[model samples]
Target: MKTNINNLNQKSIAVDEFFNNALFDKKKGYYSTKNPFGKKGDFVTAPNISDIFSEIIGIWIISTWEKLGKPKKINLVELGPGDGSMAKILVRTFKRFPKFYSSAYFFLYEKSDLLIKIQKKKIKIESNKVFWIKDFKKIKNGPVIFFGNEFFDAIPIKQFQVQKGHYLEKFFRKSKYEIKEFYKKAKNSDEKKLRSFNSLKGLNFIEYPELGFQELDKIIKKILLLSGGILLIDYGYLQSQNLNTLQSIRKHKKNDILKNIYKADITYLVNFNLLSEFFFRNNLKVKKVVTQKFFLEKMGIVERAKILKKNMNKLQVNNLERRLHRLLDRKMMGDLFKVIFAFKSNNDDILGFD
Candidate 1:
């Protein structure tokens, strides 16, 4: 996890190392080369599925700002903004609230230049309003809100297997014929980290997001310096299942994790319980984790959909309903996805969590 090395020329590389290369290698990474959103792409996200979803999130941001006493200057950083579609919709949604829109500065925190280019193309409206930052150092005056949709899941994860009271970390080694799996003794530091988390107890297989936590360390520093929060909405579990959830998506279908290289999207499910522990361990307060359905319903997505349906034709209405089902039905993304908020503020009333 310490190295950015992606090439398999080495004898072996940690799981996170290889996974990071799959999604972020400068020349051959999946995100560095393509726009993996929408029907033609591997899979679609909630924001792309419906404008109502973005609108609801926008409203939540505004409410959150209000709870922070409506700061004259505020920053909203959308972490790893995919194709900038959500931020694009957010720009339009913010405009409706002139006070928030004028004071708000949108920062799409993306590392991929190719994805940034695609985001810039989609968010051409009010070019000045949207800015891209590789990090969060320049905005010194305002409280910042760090938000990510399906963001943490994409961050590379380190896999470990328990072996007779010892830990063996998983790695990928490349041969002339193909890439293969191997294991090495776990580092002492990683073992110490695992011991600190109660959620990880009694697990034979572990998918620890060491790299993702490193990224969050940066975000956590900003939240502590400023006064706002970090809200993450992603598909994950509240409890650790003690199973390896790593998988790939290609052409809207599941693909072998080792076969596709950088041609497919690679990810592991986020563990909310572990994340909650992480925030608390960092001295930040965590709102109780809630399902995406509960959060959106509290934020009024259903009501927003009703309002939009009044103006649409039958076919359009059906499509809208289908999108809502995907987003809110318990049988679909509703129960499968979760929302978590961590902050350094006194106001405990985090919108949509109550």
Candidate 2:
């Protein structure tokens, strides 16, 4: 199951293929090899920064379920749940609503065997309520409150650049000189979309997440049938700015993505505009996208911090405060990360949107 990417001895792969191998080749993928979270890891996520993030999410879930008349069976799905930090926090919070907790079945969509082991260890207390899956298709029916935090960005992407009258895709090469070069012409809908976007005037490069869109499409189809909702929180652009946000992280620092290959965490910024459009066209209602700062504020992060502070000593309070600012400061994740909600029903007033 642990396939070495280098063993394939392939070259000039598509950008998607490169990323797919680098981040999720099953045996040697980034997630499979190590625990990439917290201070000890390459990068820390919002949940790792503080429990407030998951607390807010937990509040949203409970409130949304209440608005939906509290379904007897609900699928609480989390995609790419790294380290199981968010699930642990959210599960603990959900327990406050005994009836709701009893009605919920926890499902995690994770493929990395190594990370799955870590997740299993972290959520051992809730092991009976949890289930690991590679596909969401198995969640037959009923309402599903899906959570995808920093999920879309890690999926493979196809990079395209405009030249003359056509769009050329950026592909890799095994040759030393052209190992990281773009020299192929894109076709089909990739060409079509590039042309259409170009007709609007002034566009050069674009990274398309075909697989990401496909995944979203599948999830939406199920959401429509089940009458549930999805909440996605990640660093991305509200508009398609034609900038390549793809980058690599190693040991908590940015590295040249072309050189690092499978050694680092590779990611791109999610395009909220593109996703919102898809949700809208599918007849799903999209909530106003809110920054992490605004979302946390609306969810009472400040109040939660105050209550927690009352129980902490000076040193503990200081550490907690720093974590809070890291999560909410405009200079930090607050402005860069946004929260998006798309749902099947318009009746339930989702919280943390205002």
Candidate 3:
């Protein structure tokens, strides 16, 4: 069953169909055609916000490298490295530790050829030390240090809502305009689990268990086989609960998620509780789960801000302070974002705060 919206009056398409077409289209997916980033793009990530963000992450990665015994051949893997800003910062910082830099092999798991070009231009790691792959499975075994910032939210999610005492899966149908609703009753046990999770009266929840588990399983299996760790940073909650977090952003402003299917950035808040549970169930050693604010504060963001401010004028200092607050303030991204870590080695305590 395909819904054709080519003749529809509405400019927007259904979210699911839109993503399917935009990302998986055999001929012309958006990713196949363009680079999405910066002020003109749909949204900005932490690495784009400031070098400080990636520098801190680099520091943590270096510490983790030491904990992993500074393996001679370690894979420093990043998923969805936007514009390569984080990778650039990481490589620059890693250079300070020549031993680690010499041993590390940078592996980027990215899909967009356009963005990969941008990343190549932005990051200047040794050509021999860096490589790119579309899938994680292709990478051979090694001590791995994985980083995924705001990557999970972008993976397509199955939105659902409980109604009339039954769990209904949402689908989009194209007509005059793209229409969306609980299109059908879920039949599979997985769907049943989602329905049960959403059954609480007056509660609405969205689940991405399939995407979440698949990624987790892939990384966990690799980490289990080879000693390594994963650091995940994203906006989310510590516990799974009923709430609507699907949102769209364009030109740094919030926009209706359902209004422009392929033209804007689409994301949903991650359920860290489920992620934590996943690692635990997989028998991987859980390192830490904490808010980004707390993690940054623990990593000395305040002191770093002070040092940066010392070199700037009053106006520059004020701007730096605001940016710091925006990233760490509870009223802003502070409470909205979270950090989680899972490690194969059980001895070392993670450097980031919990």
lDDT of 1 by residue, 53-89 (tens): 8889899999999999899999999998998778888
Per-candidate clashes come to 0, 2, 0
Whole-model lDDT for model 3 versus the true structure? Answer: 0.74
TM-score of each: 0.96, 0.93, 0.88
Ranking by TM-score: 1, 2, 3
Candidates 1 and 2 compared: the better one by lDDT is 1
> Against the hidden true structure, what lDDT does model 2 obtain?
0.83
Q: Candidate 3: which pairs clash?
A: none
Task: Summing lDDT over every window of 10 consecutive residues in candidate 3, give the lowest-scoring window.
Answer: 1-10
Better of 2 and 3 by lDDT: 2
Tens-place lDDT per residue, model 3, 1-354, is: 153334234443334555455443444554556566766776677887778888888888888887777778789899888689899988898889999888888898886787788889987766888888876765586788788898887776666666666666666554544454435665577455554432232445555546656777788888888878788999888767777677777677897765654556767788887777677778887766888999988888888888888889999988877778778989888889999898788656668755
Candidate 2, 13: how far from true, in Å? Answer: 1.0
